[model samples]
Target: MIRIAGLGLVAVLLAACSGQTETGGTAQAVGAAGPTGTATVPGVPAATVAFEGGDQLSPKDPIVVRASGGTLQAVTVTNPQTGNAVKGALSPDKTTWTSNDRLRYGATYQAVATAVNPAGAASEQRGEVRTIKPSGVATASLFQPSSGDFGVGLVLGLKFDHDITDKATVEKSFKVTSSPAQDGGWYWVGKREVHYRPKEYWKAGSTVKLETTTFGMPIGGGVYGGQDVSATYKVHDSWIAKADGKTHQMKAFHNGQLVKTAPISMGKTVDTPPRGPTPTFNGTHTVLSKVDHTIMDSCSYGVCEGDPGYYKAPENWDVRISNDGEYLHENLKTVGVQGSDNVSNGCLNMNTENAKWFFDNFNAGDVVEVTNSGGPQLSINNGHGDWAISWSAWQAGSALRG
Candidate 1:
């Protein structure tokens, strides 16, 4: 015999009373007794299952479940393909169940919860969600001074193919080593490019190595790529050359020792214009800056005002040997004034910084042996003075450079 509980009988009676009876048909069944003094339908298990929270999941977070008005029997969450499973028990009140496991990045997971009522019948509910990985490194490329060129001004530059998420990690991958070691640091120019220069120019005759090891860096949210690279170059010799305007000669030095001395023409006195007069004397000067192409104008030096003769010059051959407008450059035209007293506006005219091997070896601080100029030594303004300025003077400049 079927026995209906107080609440169950009320529910059945309400359903039966809602229906109308026909003339020949018996009265609709009600309560624990139907038309024949017994309930026609069997009892329905009282289980009710549901997820406490909405069916959504985060990649690396946890999920919760709940069941009510029943006895919760089991709770299981699993990754179908991977067969990874997590099992938990429901609270005694049959209200909730919770699984403890961090969801995997870039993965999908499934969960199923079950419960039974006092009658021993069961009910179930299921859910699914997907997770994604964070972005990261794709690739990198190193450029400039391609592998074998040497000297102080050889700037190490790197370009990246993808934007990096972790700049420090990517930067740490770049490594530098110098023989006859000197201290230096890397400065970032932009999103993809970075430049490395010694605190001063490289010491003459020093060896340098550059390496990039950005192989599998997580450069951003959900991306990754690239490989390792390395390049090495040698500093051949110190080719510091001194140019005297009055004497019209350039003396070269190597490794703090005297080498060949060559005749050079300097800017003429009339050439000194408004920009500022280049120094007249010669001394140890380092190559501070170099340009491949530039416009040379007499008006820039105050030679002529408007429409002064403009020369689209090949600056590649020009080497800025001093802070002022002075440069050690090739002057195929002024070969006659090289050995004798013939001044330029301020530039030191060389046959060729490259041809003289000056470009090939001289660095920012190597000594340039200048003597015999009519005036005082050229003032230090453009580049860092190595031995050109006294140690005390150099220390003073350090604060400014920083």
Candidate 2:
């Protein structure tokens, strides 16, 4: 027997009546009754619907139809409201039919079964079951890598419409697979958000898929999963840029081959208590997004309009690497001093030619490692800073971890 989880259902046996079976106004005598008063007919088909007691069924409960005394011809369960048939599978010997897909809540389904006896007689059985209405439904959706090719450093991010108290059950409902299987796990950032990442960066040219069969799943506090959701994304070639603050240069690598090395001006050391210095953060930062042309304003971060060393100017080829207002963008004024000095606020100042080339080569999910910046390490909560955490520490964030 299959165990039903939190469905509040009581198991009961369903018995078929013994007597003449009629179909289309034609009556045929079934096998005579035995000592137990149950019909035992040879070469006669018998069909029965299996369910727990009561007319109302939980969406988590599976609809099952079994055949006896003959081979089953076909079985179908349809939702009249949506005009969609429930997906299910039949046993190898044609003895049982079991639903394979999740059912909709607060919906009614009609089950029909047809069987044939060895003597070439056919019989049909029909039944109806209604799914119980959920008190509330919880919804979730993927917010990162929105269906496109990205760099290998991508981490799948899922955000819930509401708070989910039952993290383990909700996490277990997800099915994440890759073209070549890679080990990965989900880490809950909070009650409403979760992130998934592989043990290492995704292999180049790998296709990853994430799906959750949350429909009808019991979430905590009498809430069920609203519906199922899924996403598919592909990983392009590995593109990583390493910026050395000490050398004032950034090196670009593609598929482990050094492609381009360009001079860059990092954030200058201008310490202001509370808000801290303007030095660039030192860590492995994932590329979040890119803008072809945008206005770079120092006041947007911390420097004010009238404050010293404050400036707002139109920038080009801006690629945002952190939420802390750090980016790789073109700044013509810093071009002459690019390789020799650190003069900008917090962004990496690059020449127009090199900045445009970097923008054309790298997309989202790419990594940019910064070193010798003399600033605080990036936090995991800052933009795509998933790589900031160590492997063992990252695994410890999982709710399923012991």
Error of 1 at 359 (Å): 7.2
Q: Write the per-residue lDDT of candidate 1 for residues 240-333, one digit (tens) a residue.
A: 5656555666666565576667777665544444434344445555566565445565555555644434334444356676555566667666
RMSD (Cα, Å) of model 2: 9.0
Q: Give the runs in model 1 whose Cα sits over 4 Å from its true position.
A: 1-143, 152-154, 160-167, 179-182, 189-192, 198-207, 219-228, 242-249, 262-307, 312-327, 332-347, 351-402
TM-score of each predicted structure versus truth: 0.41, 0.74
- The CA lDDT of each predicted structure is 0.54, 0.78
The lowest-lDDT stretch of 10 consecutive residues in candidate 2 is: 1-10
Error (Å) of candidate 2 at residue 318 is 1.4
Q: Pick the candidate with the highest lDDT.
A: 2
Model 2 misplacement above 4 A: 1-62, 65-102, 110-127, 179-181, 272-276, 297-311
Q: Give the lowest summed-lDDT range of ten residues in model 1.
A: 12-21
Clashing pairs in 2: none
Candidate 1 whole-model C-alpha lDDT, 0 to 1: 0.54
